[model samples]
Target: MDTRERYAAYAERIAGVSPSYAAWARSLDDGVVSVLDEVPESKRQPELLFAVARRLGADPADPGALRALVQEARPALLGALTSATVQANDPRRLAPVVPLFAALAARVGRPLGLVDAGAAAGLCSIPDRVTLDYVVGARSEVVRMHTASVEPGLHLVAEASGAVPTPAAEPIEVRARVALDPNPIDLAGPGAFDRLVEAVPPEATDRTALMREAARATLAAPPVRIRGTLPGDLDRALEALPDDVVPVVLTTGTLVYVPGADRQRFVDRVRERGVHWIALERTGILSGVAATLPDDVDPADPDAFATASLDGVALAVSDPFGVCVRWLADPNL
Candidate 1:
């Protein structure tokens, strides 16, 4: 597609996911998006546009404010766009995957060494620190776990289809926490912190608050996050885990940036080590995992969201950012 067409499509996607950003992107003339054509495709996300606008003190909800920035703050916008890679990192997405993590941990029946692959800022590495409230099953036979506690201080809610997977009788013990990122954000650094704030859509206050709370909990005693590229650095990161701990490699929406061959390679390598793999990635991105999905799944739709798998077994289908979850029947977990 041409630059104009590409941006138009992006606008439609942002509209479905983030209406505020959709308005700002649509307000920009084709020439402006074309000017950013030189930017790598991976960096040309709707959040990038709003991140720059937020940094320039423009209110994305106010068209006039955003338009003014587009017209007058061209240099600043361009600089922010070019300076850093987009780190679509948010703890909100981890909410839907928490139950699956718990279920997988129970299946293994042991304390897990949690390792987050492509862990930006490593906020997701601390899923056990947040409390979860789950409501599952259909309306007539609904099941509610009002305070399905993980840790404390933060509570998140999620809706699930079918029966809820029972969390392990004993909370999954996270003996060690390790994160791998090409350039992990330093929660202590002001600039890195601001960039993380800007990464989410400007209108998502709930998500913003969640990030702040997660960051506070994580920084209280931050886990060791290795800064290095994937595939190439996968071995070294795995080696850093404690020998006695049962390694559980977790990757959520991280494989999309990797080449197909490398994704399979990474999976094979993890399996070779006899560790369990928990993948919450875009639908159809990985081969065997997609084949295990139910036939009715539509992998093409952007809103089709993701398929969550544990050790190549499909368990749940969730909204892309994990706002909702529909647990599968007897996932063999």
Candidate 2:
């Protein structure tokens, strides 16, 4: 699709997920899209557009307000586009998958030492602090729903059809949490914090609230954030962990930014270390994992937001932002 078509489709998507943001997106004239040309290759990403909009103080409910900002603040928009990297990572997404991580830790029967790859602020590293309400069979002849509260004030509710393996809800013992990033966000820095918040759509109030709470929780006792890129620095980061702790590597929506070759090499490096691995990335982004999936799964389907993989096997398909989740009937559990 061309840039116009891509943004149009993104507008349609936002209409479904967030009507307020959709108004702002649809109001973007072709001239506005053209202004995005100031940046080399970011006009196609919804995240960048929304982040720029938020930074401009565009209220999601008011499209005319955003349009006015675009017309008046061209320099500011262009500057943000040129200077800001796409650090649109959210910890709320990890809330739905917390059980999956706990399940993996239980299977290993060891204390976890988390190593979050592409962890911008290390928010995704602390899944142990969020509560999840999972419904395996929703509105079926036999529906099963269970709520597990691990931490205060953070909850993710999800549902799936058919029979599924019950994920263990017991909190995984995490002794150390390490975050790896090319440039780690300093929680104390207002600029860095604002960038993180602006990356998410303003219409997602639930997400925004959860983010602030999670950010505070993470900052209370910050994780060890290593300043380095992935694959190249994976070994060094892993080696930095205490010898007694069992390393569990996590990558969520991070591998999409990595080259396919490097993604595979990163996976290999994790396995070579004999550590438990959990990854949540867009479908078909990782060739090895995509090839492992059944032929029935189609990346072209808009509903197929991402595939959750355990050690390289595709287990469940989930919404990109973790609003919903559906586990495979037989995930090789």
**For all the candidates, what are their Cα RMSDs to the real structure?**
3.2, 3.3
The TM-score measured for candidate 1 stands at: 0.85
Off by over 4 Å in 1: 1-17, 56-59, 62-83, 137-153, 300-303, 331-333
Q: Count the clashes in each prediction.
A: 0, 0
Cα displacement (Å) at residue 9, model 2:
2.5
List, residue by residue over 18-78, the lDDT tens digit for candidate 2: 8776676677676677767666653346677677777777776677865677688878887
Assess each prediction's global lDDT (C-alpha) against the native: 0.72, 0.72
Model 1 pairs whose backbones collide: none
**Model 1, C-alpha of 332: deviation from truth (Å):** 5.8
Q: Write the per-residue lDDT of candidate 1 for residues 54-171, one digit (tens) a residue.
A: 7778886786665577578777777777765556577766666776667666677777788888887877777666566666655534343323335333566776665467654545
